[model samples]
Target chain A: MTDPDRVNALDERAAQWALRVDAATLNPQDQAELDAWLAADPRHAGAFARAMAANAYFDRAVALGVDRDIPEVATGIPEVSAEAPRVSERRVMSRRLWLGGAAGAMAASLLVALGLDRLAGSTSLTADKGTVRRTALEDGSAVTLNAGTEVSVAMKPLERRISMLAGEANFDVAKDASRPFIVEAGPVRIRVVGTSFLVHLSELGEVAVIVREGRVEVQAKGTAPALLTAGDRMTVPAQGAITREQLSVGEVDRLGLWQRGEMDLTGLTLGDAARQYARYSDRRIVIDDPQVAGLKVAGVFSTSDPKGFAQAAALAHGLRLTERDDAVVLSRK
Target chain B: MSFSRERAVWLGRNVFPHEAALRQWLSARTASAGLEVDDVVQETYAILASIERVDHIRNARTYMFEVAKSVVLQSLRRARIVTIDVQANAQFLEIPEDAPTPERVAADRQELSQVSAAIAALPDRCREVFTMRKIQGLSQRQVAEALGIAESTVEKHMVKALAILTNAIGRGGNVRNASSSVREQRDDSETSDRSRPRERA
Candidate 1:
């Protein structure tokens, strides 16, 4: 056989396999046959790949919006087009179609009459000091704002954007491949199709992202985009090199404890832990000595109880703990 | 390695649109070299499909062109009759940066229309089966039941439709004999049970 003939035969076989694979789940026998065929030759795999790619290419034909009735040519087939129930609409139905559907127009008008359209637009949400706030967006994604956190959410047609204005927020993003969920925190930007993650913008302008599920792509100014999967933590400092660490399951759970009013101070310095406490309570954990403040503290403590935390820290370090009217002060003995 | 469905979709969205330009560039470079453009394209797609991840690829068009160029170079090196001029030309070949310009966007829109036209050009039965399966988003069984034909017959028409469309659209709708080729395949009996269209009671 000629080279062209051989290539065409390979492509033909590849197309057959491609259709079967894409159309439905293949039986074990067919799967084994396909595996053997692909392994038999490099060109076979390549042709199969090309065929699969072509199959995917035509999937976008749905974007053409062709809803015309297909005419029966010669077979005199029954008119099924009129009564054929659409199993599923491949793409996300346009918002216009939803509003134009039965009773949807009435509901939309009622929403507009009630001034609820403003809620659909950009809305600023703030969690007050010592209070965590949880709110569900219209797209079904939920956000849990840490104490003293502020975020402005704008759900556009193409993208769902959240600007982290002040502090930390844990987002359980809904799966929408067409519309990416993007969170902009200071100089860092986090983009994901659908995933749960924590975005924290510290008081010092340091941005930290921790992925709880799926994957997220993070881009910081002047840095290459970093892809973070589950149990990955990345910290972008205000003016320093970015640091990425893979957390253990326990560590990820500890990081997410903020949503439950618990502070994980396992690896935090006394000074840093005190700062964390300040976000949750007005009563401060104050340490006057820099040496004492620099000492590391490790434990899970209630975020609202700074006095108890200071006492425990002082006891552990053999330091003096003085309880003032508004502040619990820890000092080096 | 095999290509995942997600990777295939990524190639379809990012790499497939640039096939016309890739073919044009390949033919221009390989015309004198006597290397088959289709052979190089298939090999390029093979390389693209075998890659583990696509997130690192910032520009897929540039990446695809570079892959095609490498395929051409590999073919030239392997050829028994070595041409010095073709080798040098392949080495100096520069791929234009496919920045998403207004013209590029218009070209992409034109590609979608080409897809519509390709579907329109399919044979009567083949077009109906493809439209129901792809455009109307129906299952093979649903399409068979709707058209009152055997499920296997529906599958056959789909395979033929896919082959014709893949060739037509992948090569910029230049397959003038697409319908004739499909008709030829339709006549060829692959399976005695499945090839003959059985009417559903």
Candidate 2:
């Protein structure tokens, strides 16, 4: 075959491979085949690269609504005729308008329902393991629940109260001076007129409060009420004295990373990181050796991929990885 | 150097838009440098794709132009018959400014129409499959179910669509006639296969 013909054949094969790669995860055999093909010749890699780039390029066609209507010819010249709007454009505009109106009407009705429901009794909000959920209260306050967390909200005409039953949650309390917003976790109570803060109830009955905005009055069982402003993190232990610390804006942002499905494992030991991953996924990252568990890990990792985290940890610490049916075990190599 | 989805997306958004300008620049020099413009483009893409990371590439347009220039230079060197004028032209090649010019802005706006035309130029079955997969965002399995064809057939159509569209857009969008001829030559067996009811249970 001629050089151009060979090149065309190579490109066609490359496109086939590129499509397969883009379509879905390749099996182990197909992956090996692709690896071999890529290593066979340098030009094969070049053609494959071009095909992959083209695959990415054409992905932008979705924005043009090309599926809905195809222009007869591209021509690179703008159409000059100003006739009635194209069918696709008209359809999109009407759909958007109808959606907007429907959403507005639904929200209005939802507010009325929530107001009546809140007046009746408390509402329990629970986020199961491996899920983060956000609930908007009738008072315009919003609460974001971390994985495996539960909070029950009881709002009266005079006061708004939330009971943090387990795990952690961030509260963005709306300003209602007449009705003070109160969050109760164990023996500690946080009262605020309007503020945003995170309340975490640990397994040992320790309540940690981090104020992101405004001011909150935190009162523990045996201590005087303490005032916490923005960037203040106060931890009240089950049977000890309360401790308070100031956090930088960056640190506060890092603390709230779980809301975005991320966990900053920086400065955390392998053992602690494993426990953190448990909140996001059932797949356990088990480290058998105490020495291996004590090894400090640093980096932000996705909360969803516990196995990936285990693998990286194994690689970094030079540990033997054992993938069991329900757990990823890491031991000293 | 390894391939990554993030890098592909970065190239698609940042670098691909400037292909026409790069092609125009290369066309002016390819005559004297003894280089094929398409070969240079493929090589440039290869280089971009193999890079370890794209975070360091602050300006994608300039980086792509420079990469294409180096591809031309590498080819000219391999040929071993580089003219002094061609060498001078390659060395003194002025990359377009980082900011989009008025013409570039207009061309950018016309890009959607260009894409529409490319899709329009595809064979009937090929176009439908491509549209459903790329535009309507359906999985190959879903498309097969919707079209009452085999999943393999959907994949074949996708592969053909990508090959044709890639060549057409790579040459700066005079793709209608070129794509149709190529489609006819390549899709004969697949066309017959598509006609048969090979539905999966």
Candidate 3:
């Protein structure tokens, strides 16, 4: 998306077409159109040139206005309608033909109206580095604990309880009078009829419960029952059920990204983040030097490839690595 | 299909040495010489392991070369070293007394630079497809499955990239073939290479 084309689309074309162009993420076809427009006429080109020249490059407000409404322009897809189910040239040009004309509109309408939002729902249990997760329960209640995810499943009863085992699983209860949703871990019971809480468990020996939704009483291997609520979180240590302040939103998001096969680090050292990313990956990343280990990296990066990320750090900061038999050592390049 | 566990093992087995060797080869060719084999091997392993569906790579050797090729070219470009002869040295330095004006030549040069930059700026995925087709030589369908994109998308990126390049070249007036004499090296048995319409890179 060149400066001239962006201007031409923004100023000369209807606001609708501009929106579709932006949403396509710089697709080549869209790029071609912009090029053709720039090449075709001096006036069309100038109208774009003048509009861009006169305006400040899209202020945040105007940008937001454009961003928010851009999805709608895609609906002008003169293609087949849901009501008719016909695939003719008028309503159903191939992806190529449609790209030049009504395709953007058609794509936008369907994508905005359904696709983007729908894609978000089907995925379950995304995990991230060093962050926890919590969601509002349906009955004006909530569930909280360790899955750092951005944009998660819309909750329902049986559908709500996630099914998979990754690093850790946490559950906060919302007291429903009808159904009692108990988290199923072999023999360890953290029963919740309707309350607040947290449970953190991974593929390791580490398993703990933090209660933030309501009073979640714990029972396992002669461990005593503990009550927790909205303002509390417990770290199931090698010993006691330690509780802390109400889990913050950021911390919650960090825990959920893991399910998405990522690590959610806002501001953590390379070593700390590496340890979290170590779960999904088989190869181990060793922060050999304490000084280099102390280097803080921050972002919502994936954990699926720990070794890959270490390489990124090496390239970015010249942090070299010494490949050991079982571990990767990070040092000054 | 879920080669997550196997992906790491494959890295350590097939990819590690090959990539380490490429880096060694490149470093051998580079100003930064005498890098530790162990260290470069470690770094190369880490880089390869970073990608998604890396486990889907059946031929670790070819995959390593692909990644190595990208890394090497990028490093070479960054260091302003010519890995290949994209910029032919005008072949000779003979000067015509009535050669074109510097301004006219510069404008043409400026336009060419823009086109080159645009092509260079293409993302890893798009560039890989374009290079294989235009530079290294491959068919659209071959480029498609190799890069794991649709055939149509391969064409789309190709046509778009070509359109941009052609437009840019038209302005520049550098009428030379972009990658003359460059042939796509295919180790067909060594690699599950896609078919390509041959052209010089």
Candidate of highest TM-score: 1
Instruction: Write candidate 2's Cα lDDT for A39-118 as tens digits.
Output: 55445566677777778777755664444457432333432221211211111000111011011111112121111222
Question: What tens digits encode model 1's per-residue C-alpha lDDT throughout A121-197?
Answer: 79999989987666767877778788889999999999999999999998888899999999999999999998888
Q: Fnat of the models, one by one?
A: 0.26, 0.30, 0.00
Candidate 2 displacement at residue B12 in angstroms: 1.3
Model 2 has fnat of 0.30
As for candidate 1, its clashing pairs are none
Which run of 10 residues does model 3 chain B get worst, by summed lDDT?
B181-190
Q: For each candidate, what TM-score against the reference?
A: 0.45, 0.43, 0.32
Q: Give Cα distance to truth, residue B10, candidate 2, Å.
A: 1.1
Regions more than 4 Å wrong, model 1: A1-8, A64-333, B90-92, B97-107, B174-201
Which regions of candidate 3 fall more than 4 Å away from where they truly are? A1-57, A60-167, A170-179, A184-188, A193-198, A202-232, A236-238, A321-329, B1-201
Residues A72-144, model 3: lDDT tens digits: 1122233211121121121100111101111111211111111111222334545454333333434433333
Q: Which residue segments of model 2 deviate by more than 4 Å?
A: A1-7, A71-333, B83-85, B89-92, B97-108, B177-201
